[model samples]
Target: MKLSSFAVPILSASTAFALSKLPRPHRRAPIVHDVCGSLNSDLILNEVIDSLGRATVAGHIEVCLCLSDVVKFVESNIVAQEAVKLLGDHVKVEALISGMITGLPTGSHCSYPDHARALCTDSNPCDFECTDGYLAFPPEKPTSCKCPNHLMECDGKCGHFKECPSKAPPSRRGNEPQCAAGRTMCGIPGTSTGQPWKCVDVTTDPTTCGGCLNASPFGNAPVAGVNCEDIKGVIPGTVACGNGRCIVKDCAEGFFVAPASDACIPVPEYATVDSNQQSGEAIPGSAGSIEGPKVSRDELTAALKHGAGIAIAHFGGPVGGLKTPRDVTSGIQHGTGVLVKPVEGTSAGFKATRDVGLAHGAAKSLTAGHMGAFAGTHGIRGVDGGLIPGAGTCAKGV
Candidate 1:
């Protein structure tokens, strides 16, 4: 039978059967409608058969399909490869392949992730851990993460990857992971799992360390956990995982750097006000424990005003020789602190900000610089002279 003005022949008996069941509608060219008037219906039903027909469309032609129908079409006697190749474009080809193999429940096609490189399905019985690239699956396996290419299993704690140390004692040779076209290799050998010895690129693999298991690189020791106790050495500094590498950041105030355990311990005299330490334990402070001379808050404030230079925010630092802009990083520090909040039904608030200028906080009212009809968004502005910033509310943000 003929479809539209273009006379393409249907080669397979199954396709011909499906097309015969399609209802006759001609005004809009090609519009598929189910006999039940439902969006989803069985593939074998005749009422929705013609809905799949397309004469031709202008501009960007798009194709939407039911996963079950796709499976039915490919499984038909039609020459699947030749028929699909006739459509061309890698995207269309992938969609058909993925839809057929996914085989999710009737209405579950809408929840697919990237299916360009590989066809994925949650068929594996995951008793252990799944990787980061995986997706929502049956509850028996609560956590399921998948990847485009690698790291799709629970903690396969494969030994230190080659990119890490290169020459370690038990790095394992020839026992590398091999993945099929669409699957990634994961898991460790001789570990908790009875599974074989296979691993993926954990450095970037979200499912393995930083992404799933939360393990980070710690020198050459057997894939160390990203926690401070597991990775830190003799230096008393804070360790954080950024871009997959464990970095040493500045320790918290009042704690001295211990290079030995790579952790910060609270110093006795520096303990003031009995603050809670990093370990989540509270420590009491006594003024009698003060070994050095104490300075009053007014005296310290006076000293900062007199001695400091370069009234800038913070000095950005480099990690692994890579320097990120101060504005992009969260570590940007201001010379003085300010608080900005949303005030409702307060035209006086906007007038209050514009009239006093940005740096200084004089409390007189004038009307100007209407940010918007709703909320006014202001940024931090540069202060005028070395005037120590008061409880100044910046107007136009810099």
Candidate 2:
């Protein structure tokens, strides 16, 4: 005998009404009493039985069995007095269960929550696969799969998009609790039960400064925050979180803090000198003066190319003109001490003499003529004025 969809509802109503007639004293039975009481109303019982019938027809044996347990629990709680009358007509009850189970169409079924069940269709069921970059939450029974962190979901797919989907503003009831002074209440995500709150100080908390980080409540947009210590290229021990922002106290040794920015930049190695002093006098503010062998242009260029620091000294007479220490004051002219080094990614350069003074006190640019005349193929000048040969590279003396 073929069972029709129309006949399933009639079968459920008749069976449920018959089951409800059992004595109320059995409703207190501990085993299935709570389950039976939850479905005590006729409308709830009929709807549950109808769903079970549809699921059974759709070959969902697990769903059918789970629903059947509810009905079996209610049936098992029949009072002893009523059992005699109910079971005496055992054939009738058995026919009712069989008819309800067997009489439904091979339609689709949705295991989603009640509000979302109606949205499910045969083509887009609750068990449909989520698009790439997204994963179904509650893997067994998912309602809406969520995108991974830092990713936004669009058109039912997740990607590296700029804007996130719009969310409703968080509603506020005046009765909500307030945080203490100097603290702001922030929401904690992924909570199962109710909304959880965290209190943070935005002014000085490095991870949550200025606001809560990636925290949203009531489906509102998340607040952005930054960690002060995470700023790139800053000296590790010189960073601080203050006034809801990152403050840098100093930069690395080879770098200096930018004039108008918090960023650190490499120190420049070149500067233009403004001195006319040709005397071989010691440069003021220099750490100290050292008398060394004359440095050839080729040698200076080689050292600068290798990022080695150099100090230059000046002599008055022609290259190799001075011979002895006693001829120093009379033969030697004004000295132009300077220091030069190569800056990374750039050609050889010079820094300010005041910042890095070498031999001469005056600041001046080193020209090819000066390099040829002063650092000729001769010996280096001693502090007292005599030229000495075989002194090592100028960089080593510095």
Candidate 3:
């Protein structure tokens, strides 16, 4: 090819003059012969030769030979030569020139870390080649083929992108339970039984089949009106009796029904007084005491109907209003009652009650005059009572 135009200006005239002064042959050897704009080895070789005209003493011939040796050096590096060959005749002159001077990657410069080789060949348009099994890179440069996700490099397969392969978890037989927690409990898959009996299934088993040390395997027991023949010692009125056994049933009346041993066990009783009841008991009391006069079912029903109030005397039982009035005859003369409580995150108890009472009074005032009357007893004055220190618009009365 026409290699004349691609050649860079000869070394500075001063440099050339200095070089020429060195006896015949040559002296300052081109220790590293890297040229730009030249791809073909022959052309590159020619450039070096032309740069060092032949006409010197025999002793300095070593200089000429040394200069020539650079050519062999460039050529011997199969990687660099192949890289240059790949660039071909289209290599950019400026890039080729700069790369030759710096020994770094230029446009189209490929890198082969294995061989540590870089080469420049054709530089007309720009072209390079390589054959040292090195990665094809740009001219006079180094580049790497790293994995996309920083995982690994492509497997030398062109058109293939680099990636990380997924690793699968080890597999185990189906019948064997993986005991990551403790021990495996599995059963034969093809067997008629559902699953092999195991301790792990008991206490944790919601099916109630049986497990847990305290549980019984009494099997399915009908609840009500069903023949309990299969059950032997099952007494009347007990959850455990359905399984042919007698068990105590705790009654809310502060007594436990003990059919197996007969006789009712009394619950702990406490003393209390009702403000409204005829009995002269004190407030805050508990159940199960035989202190008051024997109350007949009729008398209790009648007393409750008359709006007789029941207060927990002395015992500090939860405060509440009567829900149902019992006819003492049925058993006890009391019913359920809910105590006052703050929703949550509330500190003031009596204050909350007071405020709620006030609100209720206000709302009640809208419909019935009873609120005003009740408010008077609670030490609540009307809004018109005017503001006062340590009190709302209306000060509490009693």
Candidate 4:
């Protein structure tokens, strides 16, 4: 299992100069791929595998940085320790950072509220009040806001601030809600837009809220209940506001952070079912409240676990005797890189991640970077091969 030739040429001119400056033994090593397993005589499969194999190897090589290199990489805008922690020790930390740094456009550096230690603190700076048990910001807080909730300062405006129902236009026979003057058709509870907003109408409108537009189901309704009121469930620790809203200062009796929204959720009672399965891994039910794929711990866990078998290592720098295989503490940014190597014997095995929902998205980009760094393949292209080997040429096996 000798290391292979260098997979892709180290591109950063500065990095190349730095590598040249390092002693011969410290220079970037070559990576080579060995095809000892089942060979695909089929040209298509062979071409695909051959093209993908180098990258597969590189993917495995990125996560084993020492605490020092890992910290430097984080400080250098190459990687985030928090993001790396989520990926855990099995993946390459330094190599992944190097690969990403090498591939970045000239003058590009990890930046903004997206990176670890963003200039902004997510801690809710505002004192939020649960008016009569409903979670809300003060009317002074713009009702329409896309900012991260729970952390951002909110002025505590809770409850239905809708125009008086008495002022609403007449209800039509066809189930269409007519709006009064100065109002337009809108989702109820008045979204950012000020028109007569569309209401979830949990009280009535089955198809709209829970079941029907007429009979209202407030508390216990089917999960599929169209009525907004019916769909929201009640838990013990939460304060129930009249109209339709619940304030949860803490997680439900059985849940933890849903991992997706970073919000509290119901923890599974079956934590013992599998060491792989644990609390705070699934996307909490709250995710469903919003549009788009809600980040869920369960889904994220599945993604993180799927790639665990890949072996990773830091190949260069003063890396000897340094700690490797660190945990990814937080989420990775959109284009963050991840290092990987093939599992010695098995193609797959148990995988773990700190936040499950984010695992899949982060894995994709990390794998992309792995493939690109090692095989000269595009990051997007590497995803097709799952956890294949990358360029380990002479140092490890191809």
Candidate 5:
């Protein structure tokens, strides 16, 4: 307390504390993680949004360039993840990157105003003048631009630009005039503008069969046109336009062209003979309309063939031998005999029969007789042996 050796040190420490408490010039804190910090992040994001707005107003190419710059900055700085998090959705980030990569202008000559001006200088000044049939682009670039009547340019050399080819037929360039050879300019119905017309080949265009069938180009009533490809029941790729008319070359399965008509009609189901030799035709009974179950021709054929085979096999061997050519021919008409018992002493007969039945069932018609014979042939003689009842009859039981 009496001015010892620590007295000067204590005075200096107090003075330093007082100075620390005094107000001083403010300084910003160092940014952490670069622009990932909230303040810097928002500032960069705002700058990007502003640039995008200006670029959009400028044109498509400008927007592309702006997006490309943003992408390059984010990637080069290793902050793509941070940018995506700030954007709040990876899809938006992906879309931005995609837009930057695709649909951008190509070639070296400049068309953008700012870029074109950068290429101009005192020594290599812009001509702002071009020969007849040619024009100065950008009014700043020194390059002389020329293109055909169908071409155009702002500040760079002109060239033809076409849309990607389509997969369908009648492939042609999108920039080509629709009213070229083999095509007619037909006005769209309900449209007043002459520019709303479409070009089509009325002679071969299936949709505009005969002429501008749906258009009233001359201000008259629209001509009705048939879309041949839209004809019901006509096989796809089988209908065509000929001489301005829809010509159906073929009808789809289960359909037929009615006599003296171009339309397709369903095939009529015919009546068949039932038990007691009665025709299976529909009739109006007291209760209601009575009709027999319809059988397809294919089904009937398969049933008859299956039944005839069983009958022949049962009778051909022991009941009566094939003594004449007619008997042989009749047996031949039917398919191979259905086996009632497996071949004796063969270990594989049961498995082989089962496999054959499965194969035939999938590849061709499998009837009750086939299943029953398959079981019985393998010496199976219980309920399983009669897998299907009425194994060898041609009636509905089959």
Candidate 6:
């Protein structure tokens, strides 16, 4: 090999001056090795020695003994004589140099995390290399590999790119319920019977499911006991707070529905008598007390058909409704028109009792064109919530 054919591309004169000061025993005097274009070639120990007269030339060789040529100049003293064997490595110049100079990988896939270890091929290039799940970064210097997508590095291995792995739970935005005024019920993830979250229960919203909200458990959660059954098909007659928590009250035996009080009250002659029924017991202008047998459901029904009104004279019986709901032959009515507290929250208000002042004289008859004209001479006479027309005796709202 012609040693003169090699060239160095040194960076600074000072670097070359510093390296040229090495002792060149006897083969020279004060060896001010300029390391410029010079003449010095020798073939000894079967190892070739090239000229190191220049620390900076033009071609492949960089500093006098750059890493690229470390393997070629192997004679123990040859490094000291020909070049600064290895400029950067602290190891002995003799050990650092090798005879093999095969370059890095040339194909893309043949590349390894270590550029020097990568295999060169027609397709793969050894200029850069990165482990799986990582990419070469910084065009200026790609000696290091970085995991993309901020993924965690595990066991010296790069995990999935930047993306987080799926955990046990898929994830949800929040505990928001599926329906308004309801709760969101969630089930365990990845289970056969695990159900998706949905809205349920009136325990959170007394308005829903007829006060079912009252039966709700912790934080108004939906449970099996929360069933609003009583007010079932009661549409306009719908499930109401008839005594609350979907509990509907029944009439005490004989008292039919007064039609007014979604409540049930006692019949006129049941245990006592009102001072209104026609009696000659003589209270003068008063209807007088009735000391007789308990009026039957039929009698009340008949009176209801005859423009007779019923009002809750007083409150407090052991019942919840103002009067108490009765099982009228007519039907149950909604809006009990009584003041009762509902399950707090937004609907915490009162329901007033319906008014029953006079009999229609005839159902909806304004023929009298008078205010008190259709009213019964005694107490309120028109039946509540009923329009018996010519029959005139429907009493309501007891």
Q: Give the per-residue lDDT of model 1 (tens digit) for 284-353.
A: 2243221222434443333223221111111111111111122221111233222222332332222111
Where model 4 places Cα greater than 4 Å from the true spot, the runs are 1-177, 181-250, 257-266, 269-398
Q: What is the overall TM-score of model 4 with all chains considered together?
A: 0.16
Name the better of 1 and 6 by TM-score.
1
- Local accuracy of candidate 4 as per-residue lDDT tens digits, 184-222: 232334236543233243333333432223322222223
- Ranking 5 against 6 by lDDT, winner: 5
Model 6 C-alpha lDDT per residue in residues 1-398, reported as the tens digit of each score: 43342333344566789889976433212111111111123212222224854343111221223233234443344433343433433233334232112121211222223212232222323343454445554334443345544565433345653543432322222212222223333222354643332334444332444332223211344333323332333323333443324432444455543455343444544222233322323212213221233345666555555334432221111212123234453411221111122211122122223443223243321111112222221221333444433334322221
Report how far residue 125 has shifted in candidate 2, in Å: 60
lDDT of 2 by residue, 1-398 (tens): 99899999999999999999976432211111110011111111222234347311211121221222334523553431232243455444434343443343432333422111122223342233444455554354443344545775544345797764453322243113334346666676777755365666777876576677666443342486676566666787676667777666788765656544445656433211112122334333313332334444444443333333334434332122111232222211124333432222222232221222233323333322243222212212232132223222233111
- Residue 70 of candidate 4: its Cα lDDT? 35
Show where candidate 1 strays beyond 4 Å: 1-387, 391-398
Tens-digit per-residue lDDT, 280-345, candidate 3: 444323463222334445554444332232332212222232223321322212232212221112
Off by over 4 Å in 2: 1-175, 187-197, 218-224, 252-255, 265-398
Highest-scoring model, TM-score = 2
**Native-vs-model 1 lDDT?**
0.31
Per-model lDDT: 0.31, 0.39, 0.29, 0.29, 0.39, 0.32
Better of 4 and 5 by TM-score: 5
Error of 4 at 213 (Å): 5.0
Ranked by lDDT, the better of candidates 3 and 5 is: 5
* Candidate 1 C-alpha error for residue 251, in Å: 11
Model 5, 1-398: lDDT tens digits are 37888788999999999999998544323211111100111113332455447322111121212222344544543344455666775555545544443433431222221111122222321212343234443133323223445754322233453432322322223222323346565667666653455766787888788777566343333466677777788887877787777777789875665443356655433211221123333222223222223444454344334332221122111112111222121222223333222222221122112212211221122221232333233222232332233234111111
